[model samples]
Target: MAEIPANSLRFHVQRLPGHGAGPAVVFLHGLVVDNLSSFYCTLAVPVARAGHEAVLYDLRGHGRTERPRTGYDPGTAVRDLAALLAALRLDGHPVHLIGNSYGGTLALHAALARPDLVAGLVLIEPPLGGDWVANMIDTLSVAALGLEDGTLHSELTTLRRRKAARLAATADALLNRTSLIDDIAASRPFTPEDYGRLETPVLAVFGEHSELLPGARELARHAPHATVRILPGLGHDVLQGGTEALRHAVLERLGAVAAV
Candidate 1:
């Protein structure tokens, strides 16, 4: 685990050094209120044990990374990813990508921008569809200003209030970055055409109970080379549920690459 500086942003990362040359898997975290440390604490070791280096980082405003006044756009996120990979000197190595929710969306953009830098992708329950996508982005803005005006989190219990308060604060900062909101709004979900262009192996995992099940199914249909698996009784946070099952499923997906 280490902290690396890239221009104005400081990325908190975890690297599992490998013995021989191998593809490095970088994890992109969801838009959570906590820092990147939360993700590393959960994913790094498991992924590392699977025969690849697992790298995870905090986004610009979340986690240990600095909360800049601006530059939270998805384009900036992609640039940050490229910068970090270059800083780590993993630019030439085959890259495995994993992202969830907003992070998954950013991962898609990064992979599209640097196909040669990517070997495989694992997208877990990305919210990419319908009015819900745009609505969620807009809700961030509303929730942000609403917090100040007392339109958010005024009616919850103590614990719930604390949680909502944190989310509200994060939303406030994220909403100020208009570039990010605009980029997110303009970005379309990966289409069948987009999947057709991606020859790299992919594993698209979804919680059987995820609300995005419909979208995940649609995405899988287009990804001819990708495997779509639904973990039974799992929700959005499959990582927290059924670890052994999750590990087995991930191993199954990477078995093809492991053979190579």
Candidate 2:
């Protein structure tokens, strides 16, 4: 795990250098309880093998990154990504961004903020509209309540579920002890108009059964040149379960972008 100073915080960054002169591909993981390991295990290696430098990092307050009290909003997250790219000296280069869930939201914002820096995008199951933050807060609050009631703890202990226990504990701390919920609630979401104006080539991949499929369809409908793919027999966890298909789609898009 490598650390770098970005956005006034130390970020956990990992880089896999590629063989040839291909574009740099950055992988952004989902929010809370997710880390670069997900991408590191799935797409990062394959991307590197495809002759593209693969960069993966833990977002603020996730994985091995510094867990600050505030600055968890999309705007701040976009800034952190920009700062990370600059710190890595990838500012002027047209890099491709592959973001999962909330990470996809940040990628969209980053491309909007600095189109010159982003060449293409791959968004997997990004929640675009609705009260996603509120829903997340409600879910976390319920989990925290369960933790306090000893229900979750007792179940985990009885089942010897070490991983589940650790993840639940982490989620409890992040939701109850920090300003993550507040920051997410206060953040602004992009409008349909915003999506329609994006000039960069975007590949939006969503599971056929995912609730966010509507949002993905909307993005494709609005965005000038966006491609949407629906993977069958999958759900919201497409990044984990549909790695082979996602990898193929991403590499295909990267190849298309490189050809242009």
Candidate 3:
């Protein structure tokens, strides 16, 4: 539980030091109810144990990171990552980014926006360009309206689900009070052309049942260095439901990076 100041915010980060010779790995979490803890408990430790430095930090307005009322778009997110790496003196060497859901999209943007800092990418169930941006905004907007009165938080609290209650409160504050939804709505989600320009190695994994699986196939089709893997009988929750397979996929990606 270390706090690092970067990009005008204090970010909660867990840096698992590794005995590797070079190249570090950073874990980016999904939007809303997710925090760095998701990866801290999963791939972070595994990556660190595999002898690669692993850095896991909560994104802006999520987890223990300071929440601002603005700057919730993909561009700001990518800048935050750049600033964080610079603050940690990790900008000297290219690092691998392992992102889940919205985090994966952010990682892709990072590679496109600042290729000098990224060595490779592991995107898990990322919702690529197109209707996903609108769908996400609509879902958040509806949840904001439903949570505006705080009934959901209160009910969760009354049910003794402290964790759920806390998460609901977090979501409420971010949705109703911040500019997140508006920023997302204004985003130009990644297109095939955007993917085509990315030369960094990418390993995108999706669940067979996930509606976003098409995004992985599209990425593979566009990015010359991209590979797609689909796990059957799973959906958008590959980070959780498909943990073991996901772990193997992550390690394999790291191995490939180390080999090259």
Candidate RMSDs in order: 3.2, 1.9, 0.9
Q: Judged by lDDT against the true structure, how good is candidate 1?
A: 0.71
Ranked by lDDT from best down, the candidates are 3, 2, 1
lDDT of 2 by residue, 171-229 (tens): 66677677888887776766889998897999999998998877787788899989999
How far out, in Å, is residue 236 in model 3? 0.5
TM-score for each candidate, following the candidate numbering: 0.84, 0.93, 0.98
The stretch of ten residues in a row with the least summed lDDT in candidate 1 is: 150-159
The per-residue C-alpha lDDT of model 2 at residue 209 equals 95
What is the alpha-carbon lDDT of model 3 when measured against the actual structure?
Answer: 0.92
Give each model's clash number.
Answer: 2, 0, 0
After superposition, the stretches of candidate 1 with alpha carbons farther than 4 Å from their true spots are 32-34, 130-132, 149-168, 176-179
Task: Tell me how candidate 2 scores on lDDT.
Answer: 0.86
Candidate 3, 1-260: lDDT as tens digits: 79999999999988999988868999999988899999976789888899999999999999999999999999999999999999999999999999999999999999999999999999999989588998998889999999999999999999999999999999999999899999999999788889889979999999989999777777888998998999989999899999999999999889977897
Q: Is candidate 1 or candidate 3 better by lDDT?
A: 3
lDDT to native, each model: 0.71, 0.86, 0.92
